[model samples]
Target chain A: MSDVRAEAIELRDAVVLYGAHPALTGASVRIGRGEIVLVEGANGSGKSTLLRACAGLKPLVRGEGRVLGFDLRHERAEVRRRTALLAHRDGLWADLTALENVQVWARLAGAAPDEAAAALGRMGIAGPLASRRVGSMSAGQKRRCALACVVVRRAEVWLLDEPHSALDAQGRDDLDALLVAARAAGATVVVASHDTERVAAFADRRIVLSGGRVA
Target chain B: MTEPLATARTIAAKDLAVERRSRVVANQVLPFAGLVMVMFAFALDDDAIASRVAGGLVWLAALLALLVTVQRSFAVDAADGALEAIRAAGADMRGVFLGKVAALAVQLLVLEAVLVAAAIVLYRVSVRDPLLLVAVLVAATAGLAAVGCIYGGVVAGAGGRETLLPLLLMPVAAPVLIGATRATESAFASGGATPAEGWPWVGLLAAFAAVFLVAGAMSFAALVEE
Candidate 1:
């Protein structure tokens, strides 16, 4: 009823179809700016779809939605610019070094070189480790490097899917702090994770999805 | 320049830089083109190959190389989710398409230059209209890059893309192959067809480039979207 302008993400009866099958059906959600929201759902429950939609990676085939005051479909590109989605794939190039990967993201987001370096530092990637090719790094290290990319972006919205899957204990702790920091910095955070308890302490709200609708 | 253009430049730089590091185009495609030229020389008499068949050989070599290079453009990005990351960055989709076209066009043009020189040397082809040959090369390369970019995006996430791409690409590329070959033929033809005949084929090549460049830019977002 109130102004949807200020909301970070607003959706009503949003539908995302992959071929004939709807991955997200009649989904409705409202997340305010700077709030940490967690999406809990089973494997086929459309957790990734919801996050992807929020980041404007998945377009709404039906219904209506707005991400950061931009239409979820028509203004999808703009929405994606403001939001960052870290999916199951770490999205790191194998031939590129950790620093190069982070730098690429920083450049895309128009962030400064120092900021990218600092983001890597925050993720505990430095010295020789910073220059190591992503393929050569351990899975946890690659995850950390990718998290560093998210950190450097400093986007308005953060959409993370299965954020804790390949993370070490320290990496998980760092991720938790990053979520808290992003929220405190006035960025909306939506995390889709099966390990809900790990992020529960910092989450401002919890949403559970079943059959593509809020349960 | 606008942000999209800047982003496009960055993407192009990254792609070209990667190719430089990998040497895929240099070591693999370039040599492949040379070998194809040599094999053509072996099969056809040099006297016949020089003026008459040389154009066809050059186009065929470039076409094969285009298939490999264009496929790599998407393959590298697809593996790392770099394409997804780019889209998420909110860089203009058109800019992404243009950036790739520019990078691939440059690489292709470089390959074209070398192959043309090789055709001239190995086959002893003389240029009646050097300018026309250059024009055909430029226009054809643009068409190839634009069309390749579109299909590259289309097959990014699809399975069996390595095999799927040539099947999807070769048919559509027929116009380019015919147009470029004919244009090249008319360019150096002493009496094969009037030089005027070559201009129309060049026009066709230009039309192909323009049509596909616009199509790729308009449809790029839909093609790459998950």
Candidate 2:
């Protein structure tokens, strides 16, 4: 068992259910602060659920879990406040421009307004592209916009699901660089992705899940 | 921690911005409401009867428009999981509820104005008490928007939300429809009623609005979260 004080994420026998069916059976994981961990598994292997559980987005049916010293069961709002979860869906308003979308998220996260522009620029979405509506943008552009929103928040824990699926080669490289910078900044990164080879170089560790338990 | 009121303001501004860009309310809901009033005029086929029932028709049009506005408001969030993202980002859900109610109320008020104008032009109804009419419009629109948002959040993310929203909203909204229509009839001085008679109904509308607004604010987080 990892020392609770040193860990950024710790889950013990966490079980999550969807109605009567179990999505996460008895998963347990421990990662120290500022570690970049890649979560791998098959289609129904509960990889996404593990990341969500760490982010406090999924309730633990039967286990003890904590992220950044916040209890997963009771202090979910605090966990959410300190973490950012990028789900499969980009979670952006299609009608809003990329800049407007990032600005709104930045304001919600209480970040400085200039951070919105800087984040977008960091994601390679500057100039006219920033003003373009998300509905009109290509899939890769939209993904980059979504990444900008995530970047602007500057959360301590980043739970990214399929973070590389829609990005082009350049966008993927940008994302890799962003991850490296995040680690250097002392943020914990837990990414659930199928591209193991791409993430293998920088990921400090790999945890595979099968039937909802860590394998 | 972000102040809840500030969060509410930001969300309200964002929602309004989305509406301004999408034009769904202007292009779709407003025309649908105008068309409903025209259809009512055609169905009545007599100026005397249409004028007699103009207040009821106006409120009815507002009710239908409320349904469309509520559905469209939630649909935008549901389309991209924006609400989930907002919640997961630790936004105060009560603020979200209030912001949505404010935006929906604004949209419904605009729809009511057009419907009232349509009633005057098509049904030849004259407003006997403009103050009473305005009071009824404000209170009724607030009540309608509150009720619509509560039910809208409940049914959001469900399959068939488009159809489920009306099914769940109409029955709950019956009180708003009845209260607004009766109060508006008095405002129009239809059926020999006076503006004095409408004050009580306005009180009822205000009470209904207050109750739902508080309830929605308290329950929105639970309703939206998984």
Highest-lDDT candidate: 2
Task: Identify the CAPRI category of the predicted complex in candidate 2.
Answer: medium
| lDDT tens digits, residue span A1-215, model 2 | 32347579989999988657898999899988999999999998998878777777789989999888888999998889888989988999999999999999998888898999999999999999999999999988989988899999889889999899889999999999999999999889999999998887899999999998999
Docking class of 1: medium
Identify the runs in model 2 with alpha carbons over 4 angstroms from their true place: A1-6
Model 1, C-alpha of B155: deviation from truth (Å): 2.3
Q: What is the Cα-based lDDT of residue A211 in candidate 2? A: 91
Per-residue alpha-carbon lDDT of candidate 2 for residues B1-226, written as tens digits (9 for 90 to 100): 2667878888888889999999999999999999999999999999889988999999888888888899889989888889888878988889889989998888888889989989999998899999999999999988898899899999997889889998999998999899999999999998778899999999999999999999999999999888
Model 2: what TM-score for its first chain? Answer: 0.96
The residue pairs found clashing in candidate 1 are none
Give the TM-scores of the predictions, in the order they appear: 0.90, 0.97
| Model 2 local distance difference test score | 0.90
What TM-score describes the B chain of model 2? 0.98
Instruction: Give per-residue lDDT, candidate 2, residue A30.
Output: 92
Q: Write out the backbone clash pairs for model 2.
A: none
